[model samples]
Target: LGDLAARRFAGGDRAGALAAVEEGLRYGGQAAGHAPEYARWYARGLINQGVWLAWPLSDEVRLPRYPLGPRAGSGPSAMERAAGERALDLTRAAVEVWAALDQRDPVNRRGLAQAKVFLGDRLAELGSAEEAVAWAVDAEGGFRHLLRAAPGAEEAQEAEEALDHIGRQLELRLRFLSFDSLVSLRARGLLPEPLLPQAVVAARIQGVAEPEIAGGLRLDAEQVRTMLEVTPWLAVWRFEVRGPDGLWNVQGHPSHGATEVRNRTAEDIGNELIRGFTASADCPGEGAPWRLLLWWHEEGDPAGARFRAAGGPDTAPEGTADTPS
Candidate 1:
């Protein structure tokens, strides 16, 4: 159903696109109990339905049409807001599914990391930065473990770059209070928007009812906890929207799928994420509004050009360390 809708959307069938997602949102939920595959259908269906293709593959998906809520400078349309809200709900479900899986399984560890990372990015994009940051940090840790198993592989390098970005973001939050010292901010990512506003941080991180950037650093709940634990001074802001090669963009796509994000734990985390989104059709969740966001985080690594030849958007080389030893 979603594939048909995506085909229709790709063919410029707006009505078909809408109808497909509509049915997908519904039936996909219903399938959770009786059919697990429907959950996968929901993820792909969304990409196809929401993704408005341009002439080139690079610009295939239309960013503006996405369901993300309104920004300060912009107000979302009724439908876009609704869709964004729905996407947010479903994406959260997806997170639940993956979270229930075991992470220590040697053979499936890689997939677990990948799923967490993918879900984190989608959550943040869908309007949950705090949640995304938390999960992404964990994903970074998971990916680091995988990289250790095969330090020479291209996938390991890719994971390293991604971990670096996530780490940077984590550090940025850790150093939110120090964002104004000029030199302090410079020490982190490209001097944060000098005037990015403390309000943004206050409003973003959770449990930080009131946020203040003392010495250009946020003394938020999480940071405070870290501070109490003896880990003080924080630095870095790692979020990439650019690329380095055919694989230049430093963001990943949802289609990269379970193994890459799951860190080889696809069967477990993938199944869980599927269940999370699927459950929305009933009880604690209602919308079953399944949603996902996929992108590669290249972190501006110069070696990306060569990596592109072998790992471009259309190509994901099978990792040599994938034998599941």
Candidate 2:
């Protein structure tokens, strides 16, 4: 059943893979109820299910490698948050089962150690940094003990590689604070808004130049420099979301939700924006074009008038001075 699940996952049928593991776990539990030896199968099934739920939240899955901050637009979706919590719970259960099995028979020690490593990674994702490091250290110690007991074994080499991987993950965790931690600090008023501290750390992690950071964020170069220098010294213990505002609410933004727009002509897009404002009674429909034109100028996009008037035969307008008057 586990093999079937793996094949389904590799074939890109994620929903099918998840369903297979869930069914496999149910069957494993039924078998374990009838026989003590089948408990190992149930435990293994738990680990597999937990991994599938957690995989999308892992560093291996996310792009651009910005663990310290939410991306430019939205933070993790609600589904991602739910999956991370479920993964942590399932992995913790698996660790308990593996520990009991190892106590009964030392041959199960390898499984116990590996599960610990996985649990540590989940903890790290959910913003339990210290606990995550502690679990990794404990797993490393277990692997080292196994290597000492079975010198020159194939599993010994695998344990060494696991140790190296754990070390690298720990180093990364130490060097950069997690996204959850930064959000928590902002909630407590320790960090101010409009200049997201997480963005500063992310820029540093990606080796972005200070001047570039300032330009992108529209901040003074010295402010960017100070944030880059001061952020690393702050300590973080846990990840907490205090309110809806803490999450990236991209609901009414142009990029997400029911009213999202894409692949439309500039005139159509501008009309949509004007309709939205007029519907809210913020501006009269007749005055929308000139008001939008003024806003674009204020935002330093003088050529935005082209976007506002771009439905005619020649869609492209000549210069920044071109307005809808």
Candidate 3:
């Protein structure tokens, strides 16, 4: 039924496609609940159902639907949100079942990573920025590990690219204090219109210089500089963990004696800092002491040289990314 639904969706049979998916979900749910032995088969069905539901089969723009911000109604339509939530739940459950049964299955792990990126995209569309970033980070870490393990594998590179795309999308959401602000600026001619809004936003968030931004959008440097000057600047603050197994905290102090301190906490400082950072059985049990910092700045400073240490190790390695919480 899920296969039929996918075919129907591809064939432009909206009614048939939805009906088929509904049937698949109904029967798949029943099988998973009633038959313990057939759990794996049912899990596969759940994955298929999720794929069909979440995949963009129509011309409609799914996630990141325009007019961002709380004022623009509650994020995605009710039906859209419901479908996305269901897809995430089903895919996550399927991944969990596969993980428990076959820890070393590369195929299933890759599929799980893809599903996470897909779910993360949906979550971002629904305006869950922090959660979306976490999911994207997990997928990126998995893909990075796979790429490292199998150098030059096409699938690993593809997965890594997908993770990067999702990361860029999440970064855009984080940079935009309000989506409406971006649109309004563009309308006022302060920001040059770009063909790929996501690309422009992503480059801007990464804080590339005027020339880079201009080349990225095929605009002149002067225009890019003008956009930067007029664009509303929102500081991208991150909480990074260094070392230790104990609880750690990060506090943000905005310049000029700000009363309210914005802070984020990391439960496990060491493991949370770096994705591949792991404890070895042969090594001593003691964990390294990690530092945290707060950074505030406008966009378009020199790459890797933009961030000033509001806090953290004075000799922290240059360009070392703090684990984004």
Candidate 4:
């Protein structure tokens, strides 16, 4: 049944594939009750169904990245979010079953490791980077032990590739500066006006209350809360600033810089900040000495429906851009 579902998925019949896996699990459950050997098959069926539901929504998952690109179609649909959550639950169950089976039969150890890797991938896609890395490390250790136990096994090459992928992902994750750090930078005046919106978003994501965010960023608490409430699809696509030298300091990059701003209310607030800054007598004559670039989109817009706004000396003329610097 698992094989049948796989074939259907490979043939581009995702709905059919999911349906087959669901049916298979029902029969597998009955079989597993009487024949314990069928338990592994049942677990595999669960994983197949989970993968089918989750893989299509992978584009919606946001990871920390430098010069971050726009998300797909304003963000994940309700159906996609539901499917992703269900997938996470199913993969967790499969991992538990595999772990239990591996305890009694060592042969199932390989299955357990594979399931862990799958679980890790799902977690990473769903924005649990730390947990994902933990599972990946555990799975890599298992694969390494397997390689040592059988030096010439066919799976050795696959294990090496998995190890390499895990290492690369871990390195990327390590380079990401936390949102908390970004907020601190803003507090110190290291970040410019354009990034203020992103800083507010970051603060909220980090569990800071609306009032604290308002006080810290010098924004109105009611306005901040209203913006957040109205713009459920708003997100930072990039968070970076470029100094006089023209070199970008991207936020998620190892250099610790940040970009991207979203939402109309947020944009209005950011514009007010830019206007206030530029109007100040202390404002630098070289146009504030930095350029901030941000990409944003409204809900229901196409993926390519992005508008760029630059704050500082390099900004386009007032009427030519989405927002004035």
Candidate 5:
């Protein structure tokens, strides 16, 4: 029934596809209640239904969508949001059943990590950053154990890479969403006028370094301390990303000598930060980077460019001109 639903949806019959999935879910639910031996298959069905509901129908059945929410600036539509929530709930229930029955199974471990990562992403989209971080942390811990236990397994490797990507995104989201970071961007006129008040206050509850807050907002350290005394939510996390490669790491910048603004607002800096990490370059010699290929962080890399390069809209290769096909 699930396979039929997928095919129907791919054929552009969304209503029929949904009806087929409903029938599959009904059978799966009945089996879960009556036949203990078929629980694993039932769980698989639930997970598949959850994924189908959360994603758009495409002709390629094997290709999977990113389990995370949409990009930073936009959000899922109402139906998408509801489907995502349902998927998370169904996945959680399925995982619980798997945990009780298959504690040491590799399939269960991977499934658990994937579900947790998706749950974290959904929570973050719903404005629950702290809860989202907690879910990501749990997923990271599981992936770390899997990596150590099965060094050569593709599942373990994939799980580790997923955690790495999730960690990077969560860091960016935390920094960008923080109140102090948004205010700093606003003060520097980097943020759009409407987004000035949309800072994430999660860091406020955790408290922040006084000097770091001052540096970000271009105020004296004492002034930052004074402000924190009254409105602690104004405390900020120092944002810094520095490297020269296809891969870059983000870290918290300390307050010492941190006042060099590149004459660009924080929005420009943020965009550049994304561009730097996602950009492709020629290799020093004949290696991976030098080949005629594409560079991408992942299917869901927020940088968005999967071909040509990052930093700007894509273009034809240097010697070629773009022409309508």
Candidate 6:
């Protein structure tokens, strides 16, 4: 039952898998305490609980604590800081025990790689990106072997799929580890606008008095209104970006999220910007000459209407990416 629960839980059926763990706890309570077989199952239950909570689930909120900070309480507390530390300890402990078991048991060696990836991931969450990268790489290698050994086998496919997901982990970690963010973006070309930075831009656009376009800027309502007439697709909506720090609506104290936008300038995500113009799309101006606004948004404070130039893209990476997350 314990192994079954772990399997189910790993496969994404949390409620069913969790129920199995509960049963294992009830049925194998004494046996797990005494027998070797039960011991593995018992340890697995704890590990499964940890992994389940870690995996994405609706409303589950994956431990919601940053790696550094004070404890919430002598136990878990009224404050968020103490709770973060407690959660970290539990996550680390579960992953560690699982590592010890698989290392000691050669029979489970095939599954070791995946476990390593999980360990690296949990460790990464705890702010150890180096270890996280190592474990993920190991897991990627394990999946490769599983794929080759089984060729057409379902396990091979599973291993390959798991490898695919780790790519995102690597993406998130790139922010901290020394990496060329612009190179990555340039390689992708037609990028997703580095969502966070794009959000900041949108929020800034939203903050300005739409009417203010009349004076501080060259384009007045008459021109902008007329421009809108030519381009029907020019609907301006304000966007709020969420940063590593938290929800940032453009108007907030400095944060890592703010940095995301600040970096997107030519350095990070590449200076991808609004096209040469935002022409009007309306009647009378139908298919008329396009007007160029040359507007660009970059990261940082006093953050409205400022953008760094990105000389054209570095050239498309030469191939297609699976999809932008």
lDDT of 4 by residue, 1-325 (tens): 6788889999999998898899999998787656547888888887878888887655444332111112333455568767877998999988887887745344577778888878877776665654665676677777777777764556778777877776665543322224444445446544445345555554553345678777777678786776566533332333345656877544343212223333333344334434544454534435544332323322222232122334556554231122110
Off by over 4 Å in 5: 33-37, 56-81, 175-325
On TM-score, the leading prediction is: 4
lDDT of 4 at 216: 71
Candidate 6 error regions (>4 Å): 1-40, 52-107, 178-325
Worst 10 residues of 1 by lDDT: 316-325
Among the numbered candidates, top lDDT falls to 4
Predicted candidate 5 versus true structure: per-residue lDDT over 134-156, tens digit per residue: 56667776777777776566775
How well does candidate 5 score on lDDT at residue 184? 45
Ten-residue region with minimum lDDT total, candidate 3: 256-265
Residue 318 displacement (Å), model 2: 40
Name the better of 1 and 2 by TM-score.
Answer: 2
Candidate 3's C-alpha runs over 4 A off are: 25-48, 51-62, 66-75, 176-325
Which residues of candidate 1, in runs, are more than 4 Å off?
Answer: 12-15, 21-71, 102-129, 149-325
Give lDDT tens digits, candidate 6, residues 40-101. 55555555555554443111455223221121112213443233334345445544544555
RMSD of each: 22.5, 15.6, 19.8, 13.8, 15.8, 16.9
lDDT of each: 0.39, 0.56, 0.48, 0.57, 0.48, 0.40
lDDT (0-100) at residue 30 of candidate 1? Answer: 70
lDDT of 2 by residue, 149-173 (tens): 8656678778899988877665554
